[model samples]
Target: MHRLRCFALCATLLCPSPLLAATVFRCEDPGGHITFTLQGCSEAQDLQLHRAHNPTPGSGQPVPLAQTGKTTRTRSQAKPSAPLVVGEQGDGCGNRVTGSARRTAMIRQQVLAGMTRSDVESALGKPDKISTQNGRTRYHYRDREGSSRQISFDDAGCVKGKP
Candidate 1:
């Protein structure tokens, strides 16, 4: 019958097929940073592609892509800026020193990035540790050191005590 044939065709078209399903991929970098993207995983090195099922609407579930493949090229991105550094300009230490003494005595030491506490102490000397309760690192130094009568390094490792 014409009606039966039409019904059979509709059912065949509505059924799900593997060829029409989407694929999902998990990407990772050399540093172990992982990310999920919708693009195919052809060029992505160390990337894992997996076939996932599509989720229902408003089900709070993740829906997988329909294709799985590797990429041959990587997209370039911009790098972040370096950390900020604090300097000492004013204060009596600069004036007290003699003529050329000012330049030689008042030397500014910019702590290198990723330097540990021991490294800083070795470069500068034993700092007078100040008590802190609010999760902050504060070091105090008097006229014993170079210029800037008082010096303080904040939690971010910036000098703010005095210059």
Candidate 2:
């Protein structure tokens, strides 16, 4: 057992660890959301591969990967087939709301004050007509019954006071 242990130790000290190279994938969805992962992305997303190799031996430092060139593989070079749907409340909106609250508000189609332009656009789709007068912007929408609903935004791009 002692001789075997010595032999194993000698072998380990003599052998240099093999260099390993890992392939990393950077995926971007149609909405331009980026994510990096070892696993590849779906067919709908744009795929980019980044390869990094292990550092050389005896240097006591890891070598940085060279930025040779970038490779981007996309499913389709043309525009996406479907439109992107932005969430109602997230993405650093001033109106901070929980998931449930945002979902309920979206379902109810409620556009509250303090909500940004993007927030309103997310909750209710694009307006039928937009008009700007005296630094205030108004978004007009016509319902199925031909009833028109209007939302006004102040110069700051936030809904005024209350709905």
Candidate 3:
């Protein structure tokens, strides 16, 4: 009985506790800049609260994402659960500039969030300089006015934040 009690006490002391959980906020400003932080955002920006906890190994559950209204094509879902379409406000992806080809051509005149490298290239023409680091790609451009602009893309080749 004494050995059992000692073993139990040692196991209680040595075994790791569950990973710490945290509350994160995803905020997007009116201009379409997205930021994730522990601190909350101002009322102006759209805010989303995400409770993150590290599940034990072999839990067989996926990590939770922010509950945007739109449905995503998850591996487990046979069909999209929600009836929302792409480019909607609550979609997991950011606000994309979508419309008819002609309208999109006009929209692409100015770089915006949720654009692809090809779209940006078509809008602003080829970049003057290109660099890649940490799986992120950046394009540097010099306009006729001698001003400079830089756009960055994530590993998935989509624009990151607002330009």
Candidate 4:
């Protein structure tokens, strides 16, 4: 029995046990580098581990998922989301949110055709680079991790990108 326990301990130390594993998003880049993280990745081949969890602590039962969307957001567990608003510097529009929170709220929105310049700015923060030529302009937005968006505008200061 003691030898069996020792062997089991050695085996565990060599190979990770799935029972203790947490769900993660795995991404394989084109350069053949693989990365694991808890956040979503947009520019790579991705694999997500679906984990079953107990709703209540000490309960062995797994929570049942609602079958309605790509991913379910349960109202019983969902927190209130902040609304996106834009105003002058002193109008209390950007005061309550952190820089990351601002980015989160903005990035979730799509830049639609015919959106005003100010509306685009409200949906997405300032552009990293701006270039204009022949009455068409492009605003480049780049996150620190190299994810980017290029928003083009027509001569009328309205978005030319798809909704």
**Which candidate gets the maximum TM-score versus the true structure?**
2
TM-score to native of every candidate shown: 0.23, 0.40, 0.38, 0.33
Model 1 residue runs over 4 Å out of place are 1-110, 145-163
Runs of candidate 2 with Cα error greater than 4 angstroms are: 1-100
lDDT of 1 at 71: 54
Cα shift from native, residue 60, model 2 (Å): 28
- Summarize candidate 4's per-residue lDDT along 1-163 as a digit string, tens digits: 9999999999989996445435677777777777777775666565655553335555566555765658678988687598657755531232344456545656886565556567668897788899989978899999889998888877767667455
TM-score, ranked from best to worst:
2, 3, 4, 1
lDDT of 3: 0.79
Q: On a 0 to 100 scale, what is the lDDT of residue 2 in model 3?
A: 100
Clash-forming residue pairs, model 4: none
The lowest-lDDT stretch of 10 consecutive residues in candidate 2 is 89-98
Better of 3 and 4 by lDDT: 3
> Pairing residues by index, what is the TM-score of model 4?
0.33
Clashes of 2: 0
TM-score winner between candidates 1 and 4: 4
The most accurate candidate by lDDT is: 2
- Cα deviation at 123, candidate 2, in Å, is 1.1
